[model samples]
Every structure is written in structure tokens, then in C-alpha cells.
Target chain A: MTVDLRRAPAEKAVAWRRSPAGPPRASQKRQTVIRQRQYWGRLFVLPAVVLVSLLIIVPSIQGLYYSFTNWNGRSATWVGLDNYINGIFLSPDFARIALNSVCVVLSVPFGVALSVIVANLLANNLWGRAWFRGIYFLPIALSWVVIGITFAYLLSGRGPINGLLSSVGLGMFSQDWLGGETSALISIILVFNWSYFGINVVLLFTGMTTADASITEAARLDGAHGVKMFFNIVIPQVRRYVELCLILTMAAAITSIFALIYTMTSGGPGVSTTTLEYALYTRSFSLGHFSQGAAFGILLFLISLVFAVVRLRAGVKADDD
Target chain B: MTDRNSTIETDTSNDVPLSATPPRVAPPRSSSAAHRTGGRRVGDRISALFSTGLTRIVLVGLAAGTIAPLVFMVFKSLTKQDGTNAVTFDAWAAVLNGKLPQAGLISLQVSVIAILVILSIATLAAFGFAKLSFTGSQPIMATIIVLMLVPGQTFIITEYFNFSHLGLIGNIPAVGVLYGVTQIPFATFILTNFFRAIPDELVEAAIIDGASYPRVFWSIFLPLARPAMVTVGVLAFIGVWNDLLIALLFLPTPGSRTLSVVMAGAQDTRTFDVSQVMAGSLLSAIPCIIVYVIFQRQIAVGLTAGTGK
Candidate 1:
């Protein structure tokens, strides 16, 4: 379907004549073209390779080395395994941070389940489906800082949530949502779910759209409607999407909630809501424990590596299918 | 051609006749049974109506929950901070005239530069990976994937050391370059997938017409890949614009802080004005919301690219 505007008749005639008599010359030209293509290909990718090496790959290797040493930003002394043993095995603060991280990671299932229900509801030809999708996804556009600041106000002692609760005579249920230890972590988890719900819904809704429409219609006719059909048929069809949602949510919870924790509670009620990533920030930047921070970073990387392997395996399986 | 023809043959083979299988035999019987069980039908209909009504109510509630914080934010931004119910623009004025404009300008500069860097490098690398076969491509891509998988925090401390060694701390363009490089893996993944979907015939025809590889990429693939490029650029823009960690760590100076870093700092001080802070948060969110609204479709396509068929 491509327009061959540059292939003039004279050039074609010459190529035809040359090809019949000089096959070796034509092959040589092809080899030259291939070599040139290879050259250009390497050149094309050169900048990206250079930048990534300088910024990510080299720094990561350095970080791995630093984790085994007492590198306080400027100076380093070889103290192998000291940082890791103390940071992971001995410190009480590390236990709290690790537990908080686990709590965040455990919240992924609830977020995914809620997204699935909402996505299925919206997948039906409901009224104003597009508007609803937009509304749900609007939070993804806001930075975590914005969401965190807004929620910080909303969860404050005299905020609108409590105000409304008191107005409705449910005043006993009201408290400072982010002021206590357990409640602070719980509030952070809830906010994380709320902010990430939009993207998950969009992803799952896209998956639902890809389901075989005729099969669902047939199922509906056969009295397989509502919750039964959704669990048995729709979810099975979109299992890849559900897995994807889980992987993404886990990754976000593990590595990307620093801004959220920083803004909302500042990891407060005394490190109650401090995730590993936030702990790394405070340890290295706040407390000037660079090597300990690097150790935490390594631990976080190992955890993410598990999810990454799972995701890659799913990708390969999907490709084969 | 052989592949296409074989697929067509398989498609035809899959189209078995409906008459060869028993079909619609249960539907007619079910319809008759429904007629005999009129009360049961009414009960089913009532339950269905009730379920749909309940679904509608839940949907409305969810939508309200989603939009409530934003509404509250706007309300807080407008209301006077002196315990009065009257609406005032003082918060907006404070945000507009204060450090917000400076921070906003820095954010724009960083995001724009980062987007340009990401688009240029990512498109080239994607084209190479998608169309040009060369030695070590697989290993390089594998390394990139590994880098992508490892969280950015894994390298933050070392990056700080390296940047400080190079005296790039507080440098805006350097920070932009870091953001661009960090996003290259995802951007290249998106664009490579998009470029692979393009028919190879176009490249073959262009090469036969004596076009060089770069010319073919420049004149053919580049124009065709505009939508993918836009998606990558928008995503990169939002990412760099919304980042807090890099901005906070790299640019620690008061004058060099981004909007997010400024807001983070504002939230820390004890004696801050609540309305002004709300206005600042709203101001920072508007540009990203506008971008998301306009490119909503492309964004959805970009986000769901690898997970779907």
C-alpha cells in the first residue's frame, strides 16, 4: 500500500539488467546496506544507552556497593554486612517500617477487588459511562502531594468528615483519622486505594471491553446474570488484567508512596505510617544514615524483583497465548 | 503472504456450520417454561429492577466520593481563613503573587525539557529495537528492563553522590535530564510496541526506492509514530511535573524548588495559612488535569498497551 514515488522507470530498468548479469555485485550492495543499517541502529540507540548507564545502571551498581559500606554521602569505609545486619536484623525502627510496608502491600487485593466491581458496573452500557470513567480517573492526574495535602485536611480533627458525622448524630464514630497510630496507617492505605482506584478501573474496564461480547450475551440469556456471571465468566476472561492491576498496585505501594507519607503524616504518630521507601528517605536524608538507607533500598529492590519476575512471566505467557 | 494466507485458511476452517450443532433448542423450551411460570418471571423482573437500582445508587455514591475531595479543596481554597463563611480570592491572590508562580515556572521548564529529551531518545531507541536488528540489542534491552524493575530509590543515594560529585545539585536542566533518563525504559517500551505494529512493507518499499535507513525513519516512521510520541511526551511531562523526591533532593534551594517541593515545604511549617496551601495544591493540579482531559484516550491506550491484545 505504500506509494513508490522515487522508483523511476529508468532506475528499475538498470536494476533489472544489472541483477541478471551481476548477482554477486547486487549481493555486495545488499551487504553494504545491511552494514550501514547496523551502524545507524547502534548510533540511534547510543544516547539512550549512555544516559541510562550514567544515571540508572551505574548508580545502581554504586548503590549496591555502598550498601555494604559506611558511605555517609561523601566518605566510605568498608564495613561489610554491618549496615544490612543492623538495619534489618537489629533495629526496632526497621521492624515498624517493614510492618507498615507489609500493610501497604496487603492492601493491594482490596484495591484490585474494588476496581473490578466498579469496572464491571461501568462496563455495562450504563448512563454516562464516559463521564463516570473520567470522574474515577481524575485523581490519577493529581500528584500524590495534592492528594496527600487534601486528605490531611479532610482527616484533621475538625474536618468536614467529622463535621458531617456529628451532624448526622454519628458523632461517636468521628475521631482524628490520621492522628493515631493504627488509624494513620489505615488512613494512608485508604487514601492510596482511593487515588489508585481510577487507573485500576480504567485498566480493568479496558480488559472487560476486550471480552467476547457474544459469549456474555449468551450467558445473560441463559440466566447467568449479575454476580454469578461476573465471577465465573468475566473475571476469568480478564485474569491477565487483574494480575496486572495487582502487580502495578504492589509496585506503587512499595516504591512510590514517599510523597504521600511525607505530606500526609510526615510518617508520624512516631513512624506508624512510615513505609520502607519513606524510611529510606528519612534515614539517609533526614538522619544522615546513607549506608543504612542504601541497605533499605536493596531490600526494597529485592521485594520489587519478585513482582517484576512475576510480571515478566505473565508477559511471556500472554505473548505465547 | 504465506502467513496471511495460512491464517485465512485457519479462519475459514474455524467457521463450522451452526446447523451441524444443536442450537436454540433450549431457548424455545425456556420461553415456554417462562410463560407457564408467570409469577416466577415477575419475581425475577422485580429482583433485576431492584439490583439495577441498587447498582445505580452505588455508582452515584462512588462518583460523589471521587469528586468530593476536589470539591472540598476548591471550597477550602475560596473560603476566608478568618472563621468567616464569606468567599474571598485572597488565597488565590496569595498563591498567584507568592512563590507559586516561581515554582510553577520551574516545573514547566523541567517538564518541557524532560519531555523533549524523552521523546527524542526514546523514539530513536524504539525504532532501533523494533526495526533494526543488531548485535547486543537483546542484552541492552534486558538491562533496561532490569533497571526499570528496580525501584528508583534503589539508586537515589548513589545518584545523589554522583550528582554532587559532578556539581549538578540545584541545576534544573540536569534534574530534567535525570527525569528523562529514568523514564526512558517505559517510553521505549511503549514506542517499540507501537512501532512493531506498523507493517514492514512500508520500510521495505522505502528501502527499495533507495532511501537510507535514517531517511526512512525520519520521513516514514516518525510521522506515523506521532500519536505514540505524544503519549510518551504527555506521560513524561506529567511525571516530571508531579515529581517530589527528585525535586526536593536535587534542588534544595528555595529559589530552585518545584511546585510540589514548595507545597511539601509549605505543609511542614506550623503557622501556615490553610486556604493558601489549598490554593497552591489546586494550582499545581490544574495543568495535569487539563493534559489528562485532552489526551484521555491516548493515555488509556498507552497505559493498557502491553496488558492487552
Candidate 2:
């Protein structure tokens, strides 16, 4: 492929030389320009290549190697599959943590649904639509630490949620939202959706604009309205966007809930809120089990890899269309 | 696909009835049709009004839901935590006068450095990928895009091991470098897409004027890509400023910790003050929120640039 791409410009130069109007010197100059461009391209990309390789690529490979060995920060001994088998799979807390991760993944559908609904609603020609978009997207501006701290206070026993419930005489419905094992996980999921659905809404709204307006109008004239129109006409049009949202939400849930879990629950209330990423941190950094942490990291990477591949394939297909 | 079939069915049904109607009864049919259409217009008006009202209500509710938590955070930061209902500025005062300002300064320095590094490296790479054709460019670009999806957490352990071995764990600029490197993939992706949209004729015109490649990039591409550069810079700045993981892992000491790390640490203490922590959280979030409000359009463009047509 590289060879073909390289030779194509040269072939074009040769074709130019065959034309009576094209002087030989101009073709020679064109070849030199192509050579200069190639040289500049390589020069410009050099720094990025070096930095990414040293920081990301090299360490990732080293991490894969470390996952198989008993590497404790200092020295390493080849322990084969012991870290994966005994350190992770056989550990008592692994099942619960994996379950927590699964729960996070399950929340993606709800988030995607909310985003699609909200995006559809906002897609209409309405009053203050831009203001609503800005408001919905406000949380994306805040850091995860700030979000975690804000929610940690909001879901506490004496927080405004319970306070409002008590004032409204529905106090029984209000519990410590982040206090229990199940409640903490649920709270984390809810917060995750709340914070991230904004960006999804933006993506889906962009998708909605790309829908064939004439087709939608045709569908409307054919006795389709409201839910039927949305599901049958609009949803089909934005299917790729919906898929993109699902993959992004799932990937985020799997990998990027660290700060939220750290601040809100600390994987606490007896490890009910601990996802794989959180477990990776605790086992490796806090407990000094570096190899075990490496193993967990690999597990997390593999899970995310599935979504990445799906997204890449979808992207390629979209490009083809 | 189902909608297309439904559309065809409705089309044929309406078409067959119109074609089968006789011309002799057209006048009477026209009069009755006008009456039915008038009544249907009124009904349609009412339904449109009703649906519009419903949409307005739902939008208002969603907007309120989005803002309520941030508002509550601000309110909690101001009020006393003893259920006394007395408003106090002590938490804010403490956050400003205590360790947070210093932490904020550290975060600012790190972000500034990261943005500089990202802007310089990502812009050149993006321009190269967009305008200059070279051997292996396609594969290299694909690798960069793939790296964009891989979370930084996957490599944190290895980075820690490496950084520790190099005795650079607590180095502030090293953290900035790591932050800058992780962000290069996304920044380059956005800028490359932006640069590719600019017409190639402009580059050829500049070249025809005897401008060298670097000169063309410096004078032509740089001027035209200013907005994209700003978008990349703001995003890179926000990303570095908002990151807690790298800052926490690398700069573990009290003096070098970023604002987020300090805020997280404050929350972890058993005797932590709730109002003060809330104030601190708000304090750390202020810079990012301000940046977001100022560069809202660029941020939106940068974010959705890759996802849409």
C-alpha cells in the first residue's frame, strides 16, 4: 500500500512529462516538491512518534510483560499465569468487583436512551434551544473530582435530597443514597449517566440534523406522527449515532469512573462500588501488588478493546456509506 | 427500512384512490374535501399547540435537572454545615487563603506547559498528515486514532514504574509532559480533520509563488487554522487542568500536588469539613467552567468534529 501511494505521484509526474505542453523542467520540479513534502511529513511526525512511543506504547508492552510475572516495583520473577489465575480470578473480591463493573456497563443503555430522547426533544425548533443545549452540556465542563465531590455531598444522609424528601413527607423514600453497598453502586451509575449524557446528546443531535429532512416530511404526510414517527423514521436515520453513543458510554463506564468512585464511595461500604479500574488501583498501588494490578489493567483493556474494535468497524462502514 | 416500506404503502394507497375517481363527481367531492380539510386544520393547530407546550415543559425540566446539582453545590458551599441555616463565607475564605490557591497555581503551570507542548507537536503532525503525502502515513495515522480510544489508565502502572525508575516521579514538568503526550492523539485528530477541510488549491497557489513547504505552513496554514489551534489549545488546557490520576500518581507530595489532588485528599480525611470541601471543589472547578463558557463554540466544534458528517 505504501509503495503504491508513493509511486502514484511519480507516475503522475511521468504522465506530465509525456504531454507536449508540459516542459521537462516543470515535471522534474514536481518530483522534487513531492520529495520535499515526504521529507517534511516525516520530520513533522517525528516528535509525536517519539513521545507516544516512550510514554504510551513502550509502557503498555512492558505492562503486558509485567502482568505475567511477579514484578513487585523492584525485581521480577517469572510466575507464568499465577497473577491471572491466583491473583485475580481466584481472589474472593473479584466476583463482586466484576459484578460492579457489569452494573456500570448496564447503565449505558439508560444513559443512551436519555441522551437520544433529550437530543430529539431539543432538535425541534423551540424557544431557548441553544440555552437548553448549553445547560445540558454544563456538566461536561466540570472535572470528575468536582462532580464526585458535589454528588458525594448531595447523596449524603443529611444532604438536600433527603432534606427535600423529609419536608415533602416522603422521608421513607429517602435513604442514604451512597451509604449502602447496592445504593452506592446505583448512585455511581446514576451520576455517571448524569454527567456524560450531555456529550451523547450533542452527538445524537448532530446526527439528527444529518437526517434526510424530505424523507421525514414524507413520513409525516403518510399518517406517521409522534412516537411512531420517532421510532420508525427518526431512529432509523440516527442509528449509527445511537451505536456510537452506546459504544462510547460503555467504554467510559468500563475505564473512566475512577475519580467518581474514588471520591463518592472510595470503593467503600465493603467494596460494593469497586469496579475493575478501581480494583486495579487498590491492588497495585495501595496494596503493593504490582503484578496483580497489571493483570487487572489488562482485563480492563481487553474489555475496552471490544468496544474500540466495534467503533472502528462502524466508523469504517460509515465512511464507506 | 420499515419506514420506507410504510411510506411506499401509503403512497400506493393514496395514488390508487386518486387515479380511480371519476371526473363527473369531482365538484361534489371538492366541496366535501374543503369542509374536511378546514376541520382537520383546526385539529392540527390544537395538536401542534399541545405538543409544543409539552416539549417546552420537558425541555424546562431537563434544563432544571442539569443545573440543580451545580446550584446545590454552590449553595452548600455557602451555608453552614450544622443545619443552622446561617450563611458563612469562611469556607470560601479558607479555600482561597489556604492550600487551594497554591494548588491552583500549580495546576495552572502544568496546564500552560501541557498546552504549549500539545500545540507545538499536534499542529505540526496534523498539518503533515493532512497536507503532505508520505510513505506509511496512513498506517501511522490509524495507529494514532487507535491510541486515542485506549484509556490512559491502561498505561498508568507502567508509567509509574518507568517514572519511578527514572527518579522523575515528583517532577512537576514530567507530569505535564505525560499529560501532553496522552492528549496528542485527540488533539492531532481534531486538527488534522480541520486542516484537511481547507482546499488544497490554497497550498498549491502558495507553492506556485515560490514559497517553501515550511514557509507555506507558517504563513498560510497557520493563519487559516487559528480557530482550530485555539480549540485544540483550550481542550488540551482543560484536559491537563482537570486530570487527577496522573497528578496524583506522579506528584504525590504535598507541595507539588495539583488542585484536584488536594481536593481529593481533603475529602478523604476522616475529619474533613463538608462545607469547606464543597467550597474547594467549586474553587477547583471555576477555572474550567470559565474556560468552557468563554470557548463554548470552539469546544463544541472540537468535540463533535470527529463524530459527524
Candidate 3:
């Protein structure tokens, strides 16, 4: 690819030479221009990369290194493995948060599948498809904070869900959704799905639009109707899109704050919704164990990195084939 | 799942494909079946219209449902019941009075500053990435892609200490710098792709006229990259404005708290002014929506361009 990018000038030169007007001198001039462009292109991208390095990458590395040390947020003295030891082996919160993170991850695939099914219906050009698509996607752009607040309202004992339930004579099912430990994690996961499904729906809808109709037709001709055609033909065609959505959602899920937890429960009735990001925040900023926070952050980073690597490697391999 | 046959056949029957046409499945040629269903009857047209109406109704209902919370929030901001459980403009007025507690003014200031700084850095970085390719360019690009893929929270704790040790804790600059930094990976990624989409030949033509890299960037690429720039700006603004965890950790001081932190803490209280809370929420949302509206066209175009590329 680099060689091709470099040879673009030469390729252009040949094209100019083969033109009907036969502008030989112009082609030579064009050749010089291409050579110059290559030089300039490199210069243009330098500043952004430098800033990215300084702000994101360097601090990340520092954090990773600090994760191995026992330095306070204020002082700089490294005691190797102390922070990590405290964070992982000793801290039960780590295990609970890890479990919470797992729960977060698990919700996304279910959400993705639901969104795709909804997206397929929207894509079918049935009545009001565009409006449905818009509705589904509206929440995608909302801040997690806002969603948390909204869901907090909805899930409250005095909130609308409870109000409606009592009105419908099913008040027994309505409990303190965000208050109970067991239900809090489930509530937040459900909120996440509601918030994110729109985006997945949009991506899937777009992917469905691009799906070759002939492929579906071919399936139909082969006696593959309905579910078979959808699963075998349509789903396979949109695998790349599904993967994209999955990776994006996974990344978001890992990094996302416990906004609802912060708002409604405060990581209680007992740390039920304390996600990796939330746990890191509390340990560092709230608890003032800066080193421990940094260590947890590194652990969170590593976990996210593992998932990211798998996603990227898969994408690259698919691209190659 | 509904039969894919009905949907696919109906869809394709209306619009034909241009290439690699598939074999068509003919409808059953039975007059008896048609008669049973009253095919070609006036009622069929009415039923089709009825289904269309039903779909529209459902769509409208869902759209309303989706937007209702936001709408209610705005309404809640305007109604004044009391200091607590009240939905009124008083909360908004109080916030605007500039005497409100830690979260309001500071959050607004921090968010504004963060957006400006992020936009500047991202735009510059995008310009560089899109138009220039230095040595080891492939690796740098790959690194960026990797960075973007990595969940942003991975580095927050490190960044917290990095800034704190640098005496940037509770500092507005630290907040801005952190927001700007995390956003760079994605902003640069999106913008670079945008920059790349500008025909190379156009840049070469500018150079041929003796225009320098800076000159070409200013005159040609900048104008053409407007759609992309807007998209980046909107995304950056939204991300920075809506950010909570980072701000909560870094800007821990009462005076430095962003609105999210303020709201998060406020929920712990017994008697809350729901109206004021709604107002604050609306305030947070307004800027994002404004940016979205202003750049909607460009965002759409940029999104399509990014997806296509």
C-alpha cells in the first residue's frame, strides 16, 4: 500500500501521457507535483499524531507503569506489585466489579440481536419505517448521564412504571428497581440496552439496505424461506456490520460509567452496579487511593485492550480474506 | 420472524436490481386461491391503506415515546411546584443567577472550554493526518486505529494521577486537556479519513500553482472538509459535554464540579427540585442538540463518507 501510494505520481504520469492531447511536458510537470504531494502528505498528519501521543498514549503508558507501583496520587515512589497486589488478589471489590463488567458485556449481544430484529422490520419499508428508525436512533445520541437520570426516574418506586403498574392492578411486580442489589445491575443493563439499541438498529438498517436482494432471492429459490433465508443469507451478508456494532458496543460498555448507579444507587445497596470505570473513579478520586485507582485503571485498560485486540485482529483477518 | 419470502418478493417486485439478477419465484397461478382471498377487490386496496396507516400510527407512537422523556424534561424545567418536586423555570433562573452551587457555572465553563480546545486540536491533527504522510506513516495510522478501538476508560486512572502530579487536579486546563486528549484518537481518526477523501489530485493542482502545504490546506482542503469538520466538532462537543466519570474524578472540588457530578450528588438528597434538575439536564442537552442541528447535514454526509471509506 505504501509503495502504491508512492507510485501514484508515476501512474498519473502514464495516464497523462496516454491522453488524446498528448501533453508530454504537462505529464512531466504532473509527475513532479505527485512527488511533492507525497512529501506534503506526511507533514500534514504529524501534528495530530503528536498530540494524540502526548495526551492519550503517553499518559496511558504512565498509568500502566504506575499500576505496578505503590505511589500515592501526590508522591512519586514506586513499590512494585503493591498496587496490583492490593487491587486484584486482596480486594474483593475487584472481583465484584469484574463480575459487574461481565454482566455489562453479556447484555450487549442480546441488545444487538434485538436491535437487528427491530432494524430488519424497520428496513422492510412497512408503514412508518423511517419514523420508527428515527425513534430507535434518537437515544443513541443522548449522554449516559441523561439516560441514567431518565431511567432513575422510570425505575423509582414512585416513578411512572410503578404508577402504571398500580393503575393496571399489577403493583406487586413493581419494586425498588435501582435500590435492590440484585435488581440494580439488571436495571442498569436494561437501561444500557434501551439507550444503545437505536444505534445498532441504525447500523443494521443501513447494512440491510445494502444487502443484495438477489442473495435473498437465491435463497428463496433454493427453498430457503423466512427464517432460513434470514439466518442463512441476510444475516451472513451483514456479519461485518454486526461485528462493527458489536465491537463499538463492547468498547462503550467497558468504558461506560455507572451513571445510574451514581444517580439512583451510588454503587449500592452494596456495590452492585460498580463497573470498572466507576470502581476506578471511586478508588482514585473518592477514596484518594490514587495509586490503587491507577492500578485498577490499568487493569480495566488491559481487559478492554484484550477485547479490542481480538476484534481488530478478526477484522483485519477478514479484510485479508 | 415473518416469512422473508413475502417481504423480499414484495420489495424486489417493486424495484429491480441492476446486476446479477436472481431467478424469480412466480406467484401461484390459482384463480381459486385468488377468489378465496378476494384478490383484486376494492377491500384489498383499503386493507393495504389500513396497514400503512397502522404502521404510521405505530411509528409515530414510538417516536413520541422515544422523545417523550426529553420533552418531559423540558416541561419539568418550566413548572414550579416548590423547592422540591417542583418543575419550574425557577431552577433554571437560579442556575442562571450565577449563585448556584458547585456544578452549574463551573460545568458550563469547563464544557465550553473543553469543546473549544478539543475542536482545535482535533481539527489540526486531522489536517495533518489527512494531508501529510511522514515516515513510518503506516504504523502511526495503525496506532491510531488501535487507540480508537481501546475503550477510553483504560487510561483515566493514569491520566488522573498524571494530571494531579502535574498539579492539574481541579484545574480547568487539566479537565480541558484530558477531554481534548481522549477525544483525539477518534476525532483524528474520523477527520483523517475525511481529509483523505479530498481528491489528492486537487491538492496536487494547488501545489502545481506554487501553493505551500499550509496554503493548500487553508484554501482548498479546509473548505472542502467542512462537512467532516462539523461532524468532528459535533461529536467532540457531545462527548465532552456529556462526559461525567472523568470530570467526577479529576474535577472533584465543589467549585470545579461539572453538572453531571452535581446532578449525581443531588440525587442523594431527600427533597429535590425536579424542575431545576430538569432545567440543568436540558441545558446540558441543548448545546449538543444545537450543534447537531447546525451540523446535521455535514454530520450525515461525513458519516456516509466515513462509512463508505
Candidate 2: count the clashes: 0
Could you give candidate 1's per-residue lDDT for residues B131-178 as a string of tens digits? 875667778776775677878899998999889999999999999989
True contacts kept of each: 0.68, 0.60, 0.48
| Candidate 1 local lDDT, A1-321, one digit each (tens) | 012222332354466557767675665676565556667777788899999999988888899999999987888999999988976658887788889999999999998999999899889747778888898888878999999999998888988889999999999989999999999999999999998887899889988887667666655554455676787567866777898889878899999989999999999899899988998999998899999999888988998988888888976764443
Candidate 3 has a DockQ of 0.32
**lDDT of each residue in A1-321, candidate 3, tens digit only:** 468566767777888888989579877876776566666666566666676787778877878777777667555677888888866658977778788888989889998997776666576555656556656666645677777777788788887778889899998999989888888889888877777777777777787887777766555554454455566567766666788778778777887655655775667677778887777777776787777777777777687778867876876665544
What does candidate 3 score on TM?
Answer: 0.80
The reply for model 1, stretches above 4 Å from the true place, is A1-22, A314-321, B1-28, B32-40
> What is the TM-score (0 to 1) of candidate 1?
0.90
Ranking by DockQ: 2, 1, 3
> Could you list the chain B TM-scores for each candidate?
0.87, 0.83, 0.78
Candidate 1, residue B47: the lDDT equals 85
Best by lDDT: 1
Kindly list the interface RMSD, in angstroms, of each predicted candidate in the order they appear: 6.5, 4.9, 6.0
State in Å the error of residue B15, model 3. Answer: 23
Docking category for candidate 3? acceptable
